[model samples]
Target: MGRKRKTKIFMIMIAFVLFLAGCNFNSSESSNEETGGSEGETKQVLNISTTADIPTLDSTKAHDGIAFTVLNNVNEGLYRQDENNEPIEALVTEHKENEDKTVHTFTLRDSNWSNGDPVTAQDFEYAWKRVMKDASPYNFMFVTAGIKNSEAIMNEEMDTEDLGIKAIDEKTVEVTLEAANPLFQSLMTFPTFLPQNQKFVEEQGDQYALEAENVLFNGPFTLVDWTHEQGWKYEKNEDYWDADAVKLDAINAYVVKDPAAGINLYETNKVDRIVLSSEAVDQNKDDENFDTILEPEILFLRFNHNHPVLGNKNIRQAVNMAIDKKSLTDVILKNGSTPLDGIVPKGFFKSPAGEDFRDINGDFNTGTVEEAQKVWETGLKEAGVEEVNVSINIADSEDHKKVAEYIQAQLEDNLPGFKLNIKAVPFAQRLEIEKAIDYDLSLSSWGPDYSDPMTYLDMWLEGGSANRMDYSNAKLEELVASARTETDLEKRYQMLLDTEKILLEEDAAIAPLYQDGTAVLMRSKIKNLLVHPTGASFSYKWVTIEE
Candidate 1:
C-alpha cells in the first residue's frame, strides 16, 4: 500500500544507487503509439536512472535491491504486494490453509513464461528447493518464514527434497511450515521466493540470468536488452496473465552514477525520473516535480566480531557513541535522512500495545564525545593496547564515500587514538568481502525483506545468513527463537522489544547511522508507479504516461 509521505529533503544515499544506472536510450525514440490509456493517445514509455548495476538477475542469487527491483518486474510470484502494500495473489488464483495453518495450498491461474513455456506449480517447488540446495544469500528466508525442515535443509542435515513444498498437480502447489506463520503469505511477495523454470535454468547452467537473453520473464515486463554496465530495456509482456493492467509498453533504465549527468538527462527530457544527491537537492527543491519518500531502509556500521579489537563490547559501544548522528543526518546527508539510534526504523512496526517500536524502545548510544572517550580508554586498557587501527569496507559510490569519510573523521577525532581506514570498492565486491568475514568493519544497509521485525532481528542469530558480522549473543538468540513461534501477540512483541535492547544498548552489536529518505524528480505525466517500503522497491505493473 502507498504510504507516500512528503518531506522537505529529497534523495537516498544507498537507495539512490539502487534505483539509477547508465543508458544510451535516445529521448526522441521514447514516444510511440500505444493502445489503452485514460488519455486517448499517450507516449506509453518511461525512462529512469539508477547509480549501480544489477549484480545478478538470477532470483536465487539476487541479494541487492538492484537485482530485486529488476527481478520483481520481470518475474511473477505466488503473491505480490498491492499499492497499499498488502499481499494479493498474483500467479495464485486461490489459496487454502489447514486448521493448524501449518500447510498451505495454492491454485494457480494460467500463465506462460516469455519463452512460451507453461508456468506450472512444479516451477515454484523447484525454485524454492533450489534456493536451499544452493545456499543462496537469502536461503535463511525459508527458515525465518517457518517453512518445514528449511533449517535442516540449509544446514545440510536434511535433503532439499525433504523440504516442505510440493506440486500436488499441474496447477496446485502446496507448502508446509514448521509452525504457523502469519507472515507466510506476505513472504511470498519477496523476490527470493519467485519461481524459476527448471528446464530452462538447467539448460543454460552458469550462463543462465548472466544476460538478458538467458532469462525468461512471466511478470508484467520482460527484460529485452541489458548492456552490462550500461542500461537495460523492459518491454511489456503480452503473454503476462494480467497484461491488460500494464499500461507502459516499454521502460528504459540507465546507469548514471553522476548526479549532474542524471539531472542533465532529466532537464533534457531524456529521462522521466532522477534521484538528487544532497547538493543537487538544494538546487532542485524549488521544482514542482520534486518529491521525497522516507524509505524503511537503514544504513549502519557492522562490526566484525571475529576481529580481536572489535570483539570488545566497550570498543563497539565507543564506536557507536563517538560519532554524532545528528550532524551526519542534518549536514552531510541533508536529503531528509534521520539519525537512527535503533536498528529498526520508525513507522515500520508497532507493539501489541499500539505503540511505535521506536517510541517504546527509545534510543541507544546517543551520548556525547566525552562519554565515547571514556569508553574508548577503558577498551584500550582491556585490550592491552595504546591505539587501534581498523578498516571500514563501504560501497564505492559518491554518497557512501562521503559518509565513510565523515565516520572516519569522527572516530579519529572523538575517540583519541582511534584510526579508521576506509576501503571503498564496488557494491558487489563489498558484499563478497563481507560475506567472507574478511573486513574489520563494514558500512552496510538492510531493507525489510518482509514487514515483520524478525526480518531485522533474526539476522544476528548465531549462524544466520546475514550475520556476516559474526555476532553471537545467547540472550538475543533465545529471544528470537522464542518469538518466532510465540503466537501470543503481546508476549511476542515484548520478546522483540527486549531483543533490540540487548542488541543496541546492552551489547552494542552494531552502530545504526540513519534511516534513508529518497528525493527525486519525476515527470508529472508518470502515474501510478508503486514504491514499496520492503521487498522489491518499485513496481511498474500499473504505471502510465500522459499525452
Candidate 2:
C-alpha cells in the first residue's frame, strides 16, 4: 500500500549548461552494443525516474510502494500478475483446496535462485513464519493471519513451529487456515508471500537485504547496485525460472527528487520515462508521449485521536465536511485525479453482483462551507474550548507542502476559533513522526496491498498496525472481523458496506480527499510496459526497447 502518494511537485530550476555537459553521448553508439537487441546491436536498457529513495528491500519488512515496486521485479512469489493483471501461477505448478477451503496444497515448479541454490517449499514456509514473528513490524500480517494458528503464533501464545504451514516434501507445502478466505489466492501474489532462502538470510543476519549481494533473486531481474539516496540498477537474471520471457537486458532507476532534473534526463535520452509536474503537464498536454493514468490510491487527512481537539467527533466531522475537493482535484492538482467521497478509490473493486463499490456508497459528509462553519462552532462549544490550534504534518515534497498550505488556509478562514500550523519533513522522517503520533493531523494515503476493500478497512481496526492515528470504533472493528469469516457473498458485501459507513459517515475517522491519477512523459520507443492499478504498480517483465 502507498505510504506517500505520488504527486509531481513543481520542478526546481537546474543549470541547463551543467546538465548538458555532465551527460555526453558517444558518437559511435554501435560500439557500446552487447546486452539486448539483435546480436551485435546496443543493449536494451530502460531508464526511469522515481520520486524518492527506496526505504527498504527486505521482502518481510518492505511496505511502501517504492519498495514493493523494486521487490516485485526482483522476487517471484507463489503467483505473479500476468499481462492482463490477473494472477497466474509463477512458482507453483498446481494447487488444490479442500472441500471446506481450510486446507491448501501446492506443488512447486522447479526453480533456482540467482545464487544457484534450488528454490524449495521450505523457503516459502520459512518466509511466512519470519514475517509473523512477534518482534517483526510487518504491517500486512493480518492479510495472512487467517492461516491456522497464525494469530496465536504472532501473539506468542503458540510457538512459530506450531503454525499451520508445513513442508510435506521438498516440492510440496501444505497450509491450513482458521477459516475459508476467498482472497487467499490473491494474497499469494504479494511480495510478503515470496519464498526466502533461509540459509542466506541467516548467514547475513542483520546485514541481509541491505545491499545487492546480501540476498538472492528468483524473478526476472537481479538487483545489482543500490546506492542509498542515489539510485539502483536491476540487471536481467539469466538464472530466473522464466528468463526467456524477460526482454529488457537491464532496468536502471534514478532517485530524481526534482522534476526538472528528471525532465533534463528524459530529454537528453538518459532516461526513458519521467512523471511530470502540473506545469509540465500544462506545457505538454498535446505531446503524443504525454499521458495520464489513474492509480487505485487515495490521499486523506488522518487525525490523531490522542489530540484534545481531534478527539472530538464533531470537530472531525466538521473538518471532513468543509473542504472543497473539487478545487483540490481540478485547480490545484490538474492531473486528472477524481475527488473522493469514500475511503475506497473508484474503479478499484467490484462486487460479485458486478457493481462498483463507490457507486453503491455514493457521497457522504461533503457539505457546504456554511454548514461546516456552523458545525465547527457547535463542536468548540461542546468541547468547552475558546480556541484550538493544531499542526498538520506533511511530506517535504513541493506538492505536499502546497496541499498543506491550501488546507491550512481553508480551515482558518472557514472555521471560527481555529488555528492551523504546518510541519513538512522528508518522507522517511514523516513516517517515523506519524508512527510516534507526534502530530495533530497528517496528510496521509493508502493504496491497496491487494484488490480487496479489506486492505483499506482492516488498517483501522482498534490495534491494527497502520492505524497510527489511533482512530477506533468498536462496531466498525466488529463488522470487519465478521466480514473476514462470512461465507455468504451478499452478507459479506453488506458487512463491508456497514464498516465503511461506520468509519467515514458515522465516526468520521478520516477526511477523504481525492484518488491519485498521475501524468507522465515517456519515450515512444519503450514497448509492452504495464502500470497496473493494484498491488505492485509497474511490471517490466515483457518490456522491450525498439530500435
| Top lDDT model | 1
List the candidate 1 regions with Cα displacement exceeding 4 Å: 1-24, 28-40
- Model 2 CA lDDT for position 421: 95
Please give, for residues 1-547, the per-residue lDDT of candidate 2 as tens digits: 3433223221222443343233222111321253525675546788888877777788888777888789899999888887777789998998999999989999998899988999998998898888877334453454444788876665568877877888899999998889888778877777777889999999999999888888899899998777776678888889888899998777778777666677767776767898877667788788899999888899999999988878888899899888888898788787888899899888888888999999998887888999997888888988889788999998876667777887888888888778899998877778778878889999997888777788888888765668888888899878987888888988988898888999988888899999987888888888999876667879888998776
TM-score of 1: 0.94
| Lowest-sum lDDT 10-residue window in model 2 | 23-32
Q: Write down the lDDT of every candidate, Cα atoms only.
A: 0.88, 0.81
Q: Report the C-alpha lDDT of model 1 over 1-547, residue by residue, as the tens digit.
A: 3334222113343333344333444452434543334555666889889888789999999998999999989999999889998999999889999999999999999999998999999999999999999899999999888999998987789999999999999899999999999899899999999999999999999999999999899999999888876688898999999999998888888887777668866876768999888888888998999987888999999999988889989999999999888888888877889989998899999887789998988899878889889999999899888899999999888789889999999999998888889999888899999899999999999999988788889889887779998898999988998999999999999999899999998899999999998789998999999999889999999998874
| lDDT of candidate 2 at residue 46, scale 0 to 100 | 84
Off by over 4 Å in 2: 1-42, 134-145
Where does candidate 1 have its weakest 10-residue lDDT segment?
1-10
The TM-score of candidate 2 is: 0.92
